[model samples]
Target chain A: MPGGPVNDFLDQVETCVPALRRYARALTRNADLADDLVQDCLERAIARRGLFRPTGSVRAWLFTILLNIYRNSRRAAGRRGETVNLDSVAEPASPAPQPGHIALAELARAIDALPIEQKEVVLLIALEGLPYAEAATILSIPLGTLMSRLGRARSALRLATGVTAEPHLRTVK
Target chain B: MSAVTHDDLMAYADGQLDPGRVGAVEAHLAANPDAASEIALMRRQSDALHALFDPVAAEPVPARLRARRIAAAQRQRRGRSWSWAVAALVLLSLGVGGGWFARPLFEAPAASAVLIADAINAHTVFVAENRHAVEVGRDDSAHLASWLSNRLDTTLGLPDLSAQGFALVGGRLLPGEPQLGGRAAQLMYEDAAGARITIYVTAALPDRQPAAQLASLDGAEAFYWANARITCTVVGTLPAERMQAVSQAVYGQLTDGDVSAPRYRS
Candidate 1:
């Protein structure tokens, strides 16, 4: 067999790594599990090789694969009753930002609390930095559906984290 | 722009609006603080979310997530799988067990194997392409490079293959095994004999190890390798000697003394 496709796959995975980790992080709410998820995703992708290819952008294709793997693993873990806590793993953005709303720990929990749909939209757009078009394609939803999910995700975070107060941190950009 | 709907406003906030409508949205925003606040709120949310997560992108990607490693793991996997297949064949020969009886255990072709095959297959198909070949012309190398690079999420360098008498024609990113790496880039090069060669590049696997392998397939001689930086497959339908020369030239130039190049036997 030619080594070309393997090379191509490797290169593609390299680019998708950050986004995968980010999405994994968002999904599992555990950096270690998220990385494990990413590793599993890559292993499965490489091991499976060329069989899973479907027509369309590979970005969407890869995301779909990763999402499926993540869901399946989660289901398997649930069945096994392997439970773990994520509270101790939480880290703040800065030494001291404020007492309440701007606290990143609170925000992380809020994000963790979002409905899976809203969470998926936020990660695809904000965390993964995927284009709306690509993210919508990956989610297999209308662009409008994606936007609503994103909108709801943000609103929920603002309420959940008690960050309702305007930042007053206006940016001229 | 005339009393833009919520969708239109959302699109504008996301920076997805057409240029013609941008001014109109701005006009609307200036007139409506309420709408502006909504947009501002969305932007802030985006900013905060980015603040919370974008760092993951810059975090020195873990070695386990490296492309080179993933590719290496994949190659090893293929070898192991082939051996497993051989063992299964042996078992069947002996009529000892039912390992072959299970379909899911050994039936489906792995994505990596298929992608590598497809990349080689596509390389053969298009390397023979002549006039009106590549979707993007080589003259627009800068655009093509940037576009494909952005799509593939890795730096794309058009290796100077001129010394081998193969001038770059252009390249197009193709979707490959999403499981393997998700995307593939095909760059076409033409030589004086009207012969062609293609260099296929993809993101490294999670393992990011290197490999040296050569596979002759479908009238094309393919020299493929993986490295920390990228996985490149050079494919063309040239005579074995000519293909080796081309692959060697490509390996030499693209590596640019950054690392040792792979040697192929056949």
Candidate 2:
């Protein structure tokens, strides 16, 4: 019920687009579908500006709306027997060059192989840097469930990538 | 110090552990190398995941993703005319005049407050109708309950208020504030005297916090409460005691022994 100028809402939403696009891209693994999802989310939020509460942070609220739309579309796509094309998944332009680091492509596949529930929890917490409480709220899951999912997801990724500690090489900062 | 648990380890890796607990976790890790290595591995996974996807956040957003442009386009498509704007401005002035007198009371009630107002508004609009008071009538109460339950994404049953001298008159779905689920179901009941009351229900709000509130507008009074399952508001114009009795009956049946239902904020 925090009524405000529409322009202000739009401005806040605009600042969030880059992060939304990033999260969507990680979830969908395809750039075109990711942008499309973000666009749909932005449209929905803009249309329902009056529905947003003034008490909560707009960022968390926007993320919740995005996740809801994402799940609905996924369900619809599932019924139609649609699957994301693995070949279309985009890779990051630059990956960290740490000694004995897991290959970025391999890690991406490991993440994609995670169960949808675990993938959502991991990406929201790891990639979006959302607090556990906020991420749980966005996913509509209890905090305990979110932590468990994160635990299972980290183990699954570690097993998939086969990461073991390599001898530390001192590097200049 | 209490022993560190797996949850604490994960929380520490995620940077969610409180600063006071950081020393304990670090001490535990130093004494336990295996635990230290496991935490290190978790951090590595988080870093690699970031390496794989963080660049996307830095990429230039496409022109189509602009929020302002999308909003403008949406407005153009809706094609709202000027008269509606003029009328809204007039109403805004009237609201300001009335609201100024009650400014202390208008300090922006919580989301439940907004929902109660919406429920009352819906009640007032439809309770006056004769033929179209409800989309699904009492004869189909069973189906009405199921349909609204599905739409609202929560289990709902039609509370039998006959003991309170009101019979199920039917219910209809209405657009609700999206923040409180985008849809609401309004069930109308008419007493033998022809007076009617409505119970407005929506799926639990985002926080799922228990809340209750009462508000009166234009002679209509609404008693609203939200538990973990759903939010229900009973709206009517009956005398205060009669209204309270009806609200209590509806609350008892709908809450299903939720003994800790929060009291309405005055």
Candidate 3:
């Protein structure tokens, strides 16, 4: 908090940039546009730093910024109805590995195919490693909602990625 | 053969189990093959999820994503915006003051200071402009004199200083800060030696009273006066005696031989 609201706001945004970028990337599924979303989010955050000081955690504050910007773009796109999603989840290059479980690429597609709400929570908690409480706070949902979303997301991912038996399950310890 | 709930199994797979609660869960899972299989699927799911996105957290953060730089840019942008607001406010005050005083325009104690500052600033900006040495050329001295006199409501006459080895180099109209007439006409005079002096004049303040004083400010000597007609500040770096002589000559003629005019003594 040294150097007042300006500095504190900056510090907060800085600490959250990476997470914000990752979330944007997951939401938009495009690296460049994700960063664009991040940049716009930062711009709004900087412009309205004064509004946040006594309110949200800097992380939640930033996520709120990113989420609003994302939603607005989505709404605008709805108006245009021309979304190509041209960059939806590029396939990573790698030789295919073992079976009995869902292949990683198929799993990725499954995660991508989940509705936005489910995908957002699963990525925030399971992927981004944000706690359920923090994810709930960031998403403005009750913890139960966050838990249900996570549960449904995992169930959807299992169905989509293939829930066939895999021997590695016993070695988790 | 035990009762390990799905919530507990999911929590354990996601690393949410308390250390103390883990032993009991592990014992229960070890004894139940079906329960163990369910726990295994959950662990595999968590692992697959991590395999997909954890590399992101491990990747070298791009420069654009660097927390410090983003923060720095954001802070700078915010500070710049706020400082701009402050600057606009100050400029607004200056503009309002410029309109309010509306008389000789600048208040007295402050008049000399402001005039000296303007004299210095104007000298700096235009002394280098050869073709535009004066806003109104000396050749059009009549217009320069009349226009300024009307604007300031003072009887202003351009002095012919040829008798004193100096010639009117011309004059320019300048916007002065409010306290100092808000509008000023700077009359530049140069001697045979290229030595220069300027007389800054403004309209008779609304008070219509006359006041005269002298001071040395920031390397410039200023002789100033306010009359029912106008306020004039004479500024230069000449010696005290030279300044007095120039003031006497400027006052003598610019005042148009008004017998009640003040005398010359530093």
Interface RMSD of 2: 7.9
lDDT of 2 at A165: 46
Q: What is the C-alpha RMSD of each candidate to the true structure, in Å?
A: 13.3, 22.0, 20.0
lDDT of each: 0.67, 0.77, 0.66
Write the residue-wise lDDT of candidate 2 on B1-266 in tens digits.
Answer: 88898989999998999788999999999999878887887887888777777788898767568775566446534532332243234324323233222322322235655576577667757987999999999999889998998898877889999889999999999887766688999999999999999999988777665555565544666677666678898989899778877887887788877524333212
Badly placed stretches (over 4 Å) of model 1 are A1-6, A52-55, A80-90, A93-101, A165-173, B80-266
Candidate 1 is graded, for docking, as: acceptable
Candidate order (TM-score):
2, 1, 3
CA lDDT of A27 in candidate 1?
Answer: 78
Q: Candidate 3, after superposition: displacement of residue B98 in Å?
A: 24
Residue A168, candidate 1: C-alpha displacement in angstroms: 8.0
List chain A TM-scores, every candidate, in order: 0.79, 0.85, 0.83
The TM-scores, one per candidate, come to 0.54, 0.54, 0.50
Error of 2 at A171 (Å): 26
